[model samples]
Target chain A: MAAASAERRGPRDTIAVSVRDVGMVFGDVHAVRNASFDLPKGRFLTILGPSGSGKTTLLRMIAGFDAPTSGEIYINDRPVSAVPPHRRAIGMVFQKLALFPHMTAAENVAFPLKMRRHDARAIPEKVERYLELVRLGGYGGRRINELSGGQQQRVAIARALVFEPDLLLLDEPLAALDRKLREEMQLEFRRIQKELGVTTINVTHDQREALVVSDEVIVMEGGLIQQKAEPVQAYRTPANAFVANFIGVTNFIEGVVAARDGASVSVSAHGCTLPGVAVGEALAGGDACAGAVRAEQIRIAPRAETLGNLDTLVEGTVVDAIFEGERIVYEVRVPGLGDQLFRVFDHDPVNHLQFSPGDSVCLGWNARDMHVFKK
Target chain B: MRRSRAAYPWTWRVMDGLESLAARLWPARFEKGLPYLMLAPAVLLVGILVLGLVQIGDSSLRVLDTSTFLMSEDLTLANYQRALTESFFATVAGRSLLGSVIVTIVTLIFAFPYAYLMVRTPSSALRKFLLVALFLPFFIGQVVRAYGWLIILGNQGMVNEALGLVGVPPMRLLYNYPAVLFGLVQYMLPFAVLMLAPALTAIPAELESAASSLGANWLRTFRHVVLPLARPGLVGAGLVVVTLSLTDFAIPAILGGGSQDFIANAIYDQFFRTSDQGMGATLSLMLVAVGSLLVGLVFMLFGAGTLAMTGGRK
Candidate 1:
């Protein structure tokens, strides 16, 4: 109980796996173009992207399954580009879970040991230790197919770790599982990685999975790294329009920065100005800057014009209203900006949501809640 | 009360219930069975061929009087004993087994590399041309191919003529065991390649990389992963080549010079030339049984050994 308390207070160390200008191409098709990042070790770094954003390719190069066409990879301060996967001592749990279909759980765990050509006598014992570590205590003799999806995932982890690899790469390992099981595996993986203190890099396209599991999330799009930062940090402070839109729902309105104040600014859009928006300087403040209003941050019925000692408001015509369980998705048409979507959540009573799809109402937020970026 | 049918038992009620359930089920199952109805003619053809083979087996088991259509004499093991114990027939069987084993092993070694190259190498036209070339020798008349070899390896033939031009005397080359082995391998290489190519294609490219990533280089990967996986196909090819070698007559006849008589040639001699139909039938049955047993043993060893454990209960 005391040790658990200590662990709760203890934070992870800051060792990083640096990928430098790594790119790959099959003939003329560029798979990854100058993909680079300092993936902090001992914390989950998920490169979240759609299929063929070169996410899996990046992971493969890091795992040494494929060598980079052009750059260097350093894990724990060693150049690992030329190193073979087994020699590099990195473990990779494949997307298909690539468990040798014929081998038992013990044999699967013993594979890395076999690859290292360890003493045949010691393989069984080493295998049992890792299997037990993964909480598969008595499943050593069970075949891979005998294990359920989650159990097989744990066995794959055990197999990868049996040799105590320096780095572990998981290439979308939960892509095949159903929703509930995938979420369960995500939590289980986090706990195991923390307990083991092994540096792991996981590649996944599921944004929620990435957000829940990773310490740092690197968002990629169209073969380029869009943003790499902490999960909450990336969510709160997206570096670009792509990062903002890709991470979640945001009402990005094209505008120009018109006036600036101490911690707030005004963005002129579609002939009218949205005043008191925060153009926080991730990008240098310029006149032609774009502004964003997140749907979740938009207030619906709490229209008490409360911005400092004064008030600011913009009127929009409500075009559609969607009941999204606990929240309402309002598709409103601002006077000149055309259509804008805002999500109002369930915090107050139902009578407050007194607008229909065709009704016109004034919507506004605190200047600090809005974000402005370069157009 | 009369409508209730007072004599009806509970078992009858259950049967009626089951009948209704089955009536509901049968149409859907018969709708699925439409596909099998389409296969009926082909299946019947196969059944007829199997029935024919069974009749041949029955005929081999009897004592043929030759004077009667049916077996007028008593059934006998004497034919089988006569076929097995005869020195010439025994020697012929031994020769066929030994020759086929050597030839098949050599064919396997040569064929796997060439087949692997066909799959991995990047040239499509080259692979196609090579595939055509592989069949070219087989496409030529068997007599013509044998005679062509006879010319190449004979004392006064092209090979000896070339050597003689270089001031070397013609060496003896016609009709020998060396000639027979050469002819057998040449004859069976196409068969070996046809078997191996499909197996090589079936091996996923990921497996090769998987092995390589696990630190096994080309040779170790080929041995542990490639070869073991390809064994089923290799064994299948071996059965075909060995059976072909056992049942072969022309290759041995052309090259054996009466010294390397195969079982087929001996069976041929017994059936018509020597007028011993009983011994011939018995010998042919023995060869068939040998091939079947060999194939069955191989399947039991390799195919059955791959019995897999379930992978979901963890």
Candidate 2:
């Protein structure tokens, strides 16, 4: 919490990593285009994007594996465009977890220290300390193949951290594990990052992982950053349509702006006027726009009177109702909205009325919950 | 719907009938031993070789009489005694062993970088060019290649002609120890490269990147990761080059002129030139023993299954 507040008080010198308008082009393809971000000290930032979206390319530039065609990256305010990877004070966990198969666990962990020319007597103790840090204590004598998949992950983490690098980079290291193990490791990564207070930059396509483990998330698409904000802010107030749809289950209703008053806008769609807050660029009257609403923000009731207190109401038939333990997700087909489908989550597990397929229900939400963006 | 016999192609019907006929002739009970049955010819060929080796061993124990030029009826250890005591045979055996070791070492030193570059190059054109150059000599026979080398390295040849342009005299570049060693190394290069390529390919390119990120330069990565992983292939290639060069006949016979005789040249001279079959048989058995001992030593140093293709745990 103290770190979070300190990051909120953003000062220039506290920034640990800054990518200044970095771009990379391979032949004719632009792998990354003018990407720039500043990571404060002791903060975890996740670069989240789908495949071929330049997330990995940006991480590679930061790690010095590949040079950017333009722009520069700085670690601790030092311009590192020309420094080789081995000379940089950065550690990386690869997607494949490339532990040396020829060496035992302890030897693999000890490699970086030996390469850095640490004191010979201090190397073994530091390796043991890191092995125990990753919870692989007393198992360092076994070869890599003798360990399980998760244990290999532990060894990779230990090896990357034992050298005490200035920054750590994770390139989707947990992307290959089973869900249970992946979630467990996500929390483990969070714990280790917090305990060590090392600035980290993780690249992943897993949205849930980005939200769970990162202090800030950078959502990217088409080799460009769409949004860079705190996880909840990025989820609640996305910068554009791409981020809204990528981060959560968002329903976008096409409409035209009918009226604008300061921050509020009324959009006319499917013979109804839907009120929403104008976001991003200002929208003029009659301009084509979309009203983005999250599934959990809307309420579902059996009848219109039950949803009387809400500012907006619409009638829909339940197309599908899925029971997901603590909540029920109902896919409602709203006929007034051009027969578009809208998903609604009812979290009242005890008092909620279950709606079956083809049952009529009313969905309601406040106008503030809808974000209006111009098409 | 069931199809009639006419609906099927004639080739398919013939194959089906042949398969059923083979099954009936072999019977289901004997199916389990089919692999061993198929191996009978190879096993028999090896058995014949072993039998010939035993006959040679028997002959190696006998002595030839100078008056009749025929072996003695009773077996004796006279030939073995002569082979062990004679300095001429000792010098030939030592030269062969030493030359083979040098050839093996030099061949591997040249082949490692060639094979590594061939496997690691991102350009397909360069890789294809290297591959063609390596296999070009293979299509030409070894004896023809050695004769070609003689033309290239002889006085007033291309090399000497180039040297003559610089006012240097034409040198004696053929029929020496270094010439024989150089020919053996050239001949064994393709074999060594072919053996090492697969092992180098088995290592992931990502491993090198990982090493670099983990604070290793290119040289350190090669020494720590690549050299260790490629040991099995090195040992396997070394065993082959050593044994083949140790008992090699053509390179030494063609390049040695008259002075530098290896074990194989001595054996050939004993059998054909001197008309001494007993001495030739003795040299042949000793060569086999020496080759086997060297192979055994390699297997002991490395493992017996060093060249296994599976990617399982070591």
Q: Which candidate tops DockQ?
A: 2
Alpha carbon lDDT of residue A349, candidate 2?
Answer: 66
Tens digits of per-residue lDDT, candidate 1, A243-318, equal 7777777877777777777657877877777764453454334568777767776665424353223234566777
Cα distance off (Å), candidate 2, residue B252: 2.2
User: Each predicted complex: what DockQ?
Assistant: 0.20, 0.66
TM-score of chain A of 2: 0.95
Interface RMSD values for all candidates? 3.6, 1.1
Task: Give the lDDT of residue B297 in candidate 1.
Answer: 77
Q: Provide the interface RMSD of candidate 1 in angstroms, 1 decimal place.
A: 3.6
What root-mean-square deviation over C-alphas does model 1 reach? Answer: 9.9
Model 1 chain A — which ten-residue stretch has the worst lDDT? Answer: A1-10
Which digits, one per residue and each the tens of the lDDT, describe model 1 over residues B117-166?
88777789989987998999989966678778887888778999999999
Going through the candidates in order, what is chain B's TM-score?
0.76, 0.95
- TM-score of predicted structure 1, chain A: 0.85
The DockQ for candidate 1, computed on C-alphas, is 0.20
Provide the lowest-lDDT 10-residue window in model 2 chain A: A1-10
DockQ of 2: 0.66
lDDT of 2 at A304: 88
Docking class of 2: medium
